[model samples]
Target: MDFNMIAARGLVLLGCGKMGSAMLGGWLRQGLAPGAVWVLDPHPSDWLVAQGVHLNADLPARPAVVLIAVKPQMMGAALPTLAAMGGGDTLFITVAAGTTIATYERILGAATPVVRAMPNTPAAIGKGITAICGNAAAGAGDLDTAEGLLAVLGQVVRLEGEHQMDAVTALSGSGPGYVFHLIEALAAAGQAEGLPADMAMTLAKATVAGAGALAEVADEPPAKLRENVTSPGGTTQAGLKVLMDPDTGFAPLLRRAVKAAADRGRELGQ
Candidate 1:
């Protein structure tokens, strides 16, 4: 929690979109000195300026951390200006999708230390979980620093290898959309079963939210939790039979969805 490094050299935030703002806000709330952060967005919001962070100003000779939160499509244009920032003690942490460590190293230099992270949309509220992977040039200290900074958003998990990043992108990065879709599907089904439209939507939303919260705190696995709720020959059991059907089940459907996402990620990286 010691922010001496941030205070001394400052942190560079390369983007100020929703995710970037959420992370920046969390950092400030968690004790990162506001004066020690720099905002690099081309069009700064009034709210961003009011936060007392340096905006589009000259940077220090060496920053403590440079977070690349710009869109992947913008990297080619943005990274050229950052070439001077590489090959030093500076740690370049990128959250841009499909921007590989090799891509960063090649743009910066072979000696540049880089950590790649995939954080989901939930990070906007500080409830998101992040998957982190670092290149060989990054040392233990570098990884620790990156993880600590990212923890401001939510949970942090370190991956053994960068190769697993695609899976991480598929599962956690795109997982929120899947959950949101489930809410929509459940709401629609509730309506189909004669529940009022608005009431069904409210129930669906609360149910999914409550269930996810419970799943997090439960000591038992989800399957066990399902069994705990089902009574023999009950309505829940009848529903389970159809939901757990091998050919049309949740597992196989989600497997196909995750695979589609992961494949697109690999293609983007290439």
Candidate 2:
């Protein structure tokens, strides 16, 4: 797709923190016009300046899309700047976790088309999964606009209902931390098995990274894939047995953790 064409429409990113900067980098790397982006960050980074992007504390006139990437706590304070730009044609896409469309309506009026998204940290590499849900005021074209722009970051999935966003946040939004912890655990286990610290870390990191890559391209079910590498009387199976045993398996714990995160997401949205 021609990302440059889309970028020409003028997009304002309201934050330049990690996630926001990642999205900006992805768009620019994919041929987005530097002039089309206006980044609003109190403390602008050197990289942003090098790319010839506009970094200002003041909000500009209504752009086609005003992406709200501020922290949830700072989102309320950021709304007043958007007040001058909230109208029929303009769209507000928020990446702030837990804040709802109702929250946007409260500040920008009910008629403003607002889209809420839960994006993972992997977007820093343009390989993230972003789940988005827009308010009723957003028409088909508006939704398409939001989706197309976010697609620059990674895959885009539109939810049937906004309620599912809590679950999405719990899963993908917090999923990276869980995976990172698993990597740490695997490395620790390797070290416990008499391996050198550096070697164990490398093995754990490569193993997890390779597994993720394989799973992405695999046609078979994950369970079947797991079985494929596990021999009946092998070291792999021995490890699998420990992980698969129902009494103290990893599933139950992970399920509880995800549920807890989902619950917390709901509470935050409240």
lDDT of 1: 0.91
lDDT of prediction 2? 0.85
lDDT of 2 at 113: 91
For residues 68-115, could you state the per-residue lDDT of candidate 2 as single tens digits?
999888887888877867756778899988788888888888889998
Clashes of each: 0, 0
Write model 1 residue lDDT over 16-87, tens digit each, in one string.
999899989888888888889988998887889899988998887789889999999899999988889899
**TM-score against truth, every candidate:** 0.98, 0.93
For each candidate, the alpha-carbon lDDT, in order, equals: 0.91, 0.85
Q: Which stretches of candidate 2 lie over 4 Å from their true place?
A: 1-9, 57-60
Model 1, position 104, has a per-residue lDDT of 95
What is the total number of backbone clashes in candidate 1? Answer: 0
